[model samples]
Target: MEIAPGIYSMTQRKGAYVHAFLLDDGDGLTLVDTLYDTDAHRVLAELDQIGKSVSDIKHIVMTHCHRSHLGGLALLKERSGAPVYAHQWEADLIAGERKQQPVAWRPYAPVRVWPLQIALNLGVARHPPATVDHFVQEGDQVGPLRVVACPGHSPGHLSFWWEQRRLLIAGDAICTWPSLMLGWRGFTLNPTQHRASVRRLAEFDSQILCVGHGEPLASDAAQAIRAALPSLDR
Candidate 1:
């Protein structure tokens, strides 16, 4: 779906949860958060939905190195030849130099659902190891995008800013699939940082929220996030 003028959000099931997004910066197609390799072709299909193709991808940015996000890297790189960019801390993880980080369990998780979310992330949220070509830090400018460091989901988790569109490309930093909510507690490394990340993201006051899952919030997006912050961990 079109999140704003030049941005789009696409969801491919990695069983039950986890998501990826695609951004068009008026120059070429840039993919953010690619689902598992199992869903690799889905990118080609999704691109086709917009009358684009794999070769059109000029750069691929993985929000973090989680397997769920890296799953499609190999094939996408093979086909598109676009450089994969990620945070410096996540570079090794993406390159298969380190083991994936495990989610921490928390009792007061914002969402109190049953084993469904767990089953999906553990059993289905997986992808092959891949390499990264670029390592980015906070305040980096990528085409029309501005890299915003919003960690805690992962040590180097990032969200992108489309200044002109007033849109936030929220990675696992926030999700809106079920409802306006913080990142799933289990997957987040630090609830405090995650909450802080949300707060930092809120400062942008973006009008469109292109989140990690569910549908994108097309309007008053920043208010929606700030509105939810009070309930998160203090």
Candidate 2:
């Protein structure tokens, strides 16, 4: 689905309707995440439908190293030969040098995620490891995105802002799945950091919002994010 001009949102049933975005800034395609398929068939289909090929994917950017988002990283990187960019904190994990830091096993408000939390704690269902070619920090530009370091979901969690389009690519910092939320409580490593991150995300005058999970918010995106701010307190 084209959530906005030049931005296409791709979703998968696995990983709680996990989403990835394909961005065309005219230079070439820049993929936000790879979705929840190891073969990357879904993403490839989307590209084919748009008459684009893997080589057109000039940059592949990662929001974090979570398994749900990393499934197609290796395949896409190998096919597109695009340099992968992520935060420094997630480099080792992305490279398979270390497993992701686990989250609490206890059930939180969105109990549906408990199973996933348990899977992470047990280090099960790992994704194919891929190398990160570059480490991006806040203010750094990757394609048309301005990297925003929004930790708390994990130490190196990131979000992206496209000032040109007033778009915010909020990874797990905010979720619209099950319902709009300030990230899943059970998986949140640091509530304080997540809270601050959401607060900062809400400040963006985003007219469109794309998240790590759930459908893209096409309108009143900033207003919706601000409205969900009180959830951070709970």
Candidate 3:
């Protein structure tokens, strides 16, 4: 699952539920997302698959405040003694001090929406709070990558930009397949801002794209995103 020289892609069900990533920065391992608390074991297993151990993970970075993305964060942090990095806007949310806002319900939606709502209400995907050791902003260097402010999915939503590798860890900002979709509108806080973010991300001179819930792109990542941006309105 080594997508790049030092990058390993560890996904559960091809990220249908969630996906976490590991980067061997030569010094230590850096984890991208935590998936879910229940999936922490899977993370460990995946780490083993990549010839890395739990203790090797030096840091955990969150893309946004959604539960599915940060579910196993607390457990991972506790086990590895790694500091968690998040955006300042949602740092409190990750710290257990602030509660997440529920998705806005649209009347008479499709059948799929109901289950999504039920899960949220039941806190099914919610993760135990993990402390944020650092808050990142656009242009800040984070573990060999730069932060790209892609808010709209969440107040402090971010996408990691690895300029040297030309890889973009888009968080929920963009997803491939089923044709370049934006974050679920029901779950997103602002459609206008989301659209803007996606458009902005498409402009990156990237060759690979990684997301929280879809297959990763090996090449032509920016072209795919440009093609997919139009689908945002659909």
**Best candidate, lDDT-wise?**
2
What is the alpha-carbon lDDT of model 1 when measured against the actual structure? 0.76
* Number of clashes recorded per candidate: 1, 0, 0
Per-residue accuracy of model 2 over 20-89 as CA lDDT, tens digit each: 9999999999999898889999999999989999999999999998889999999999999999999999
Span of 10 residues, lowest total lDDT, candidate 2: 225-234
Question: lDDT, candidate 1, residue 5?
Answer: 64
lDDT tens digits, residues 29-86, model 3? 8889887654488788878887888899887888987767776788898999998888
lDDT of 2 at 180: 90
lDDT of 1 by residue, 81-173 (tens): 999889989988777777666564334344543253454345444456668888887898766678999989888998999888887888888
lDDT of 2: 0.92
Candidate 3: 10-residue stretch with minimal lDDT? 107-116
Model 1 TM-score relative to the real fold? 0.88
Model 3 residue 118 CA deviation (Å) reads 4.0
Better of 1 and 2 by TM-score: 2
Which structure is stronger by lDDT: 1 or 3? 3
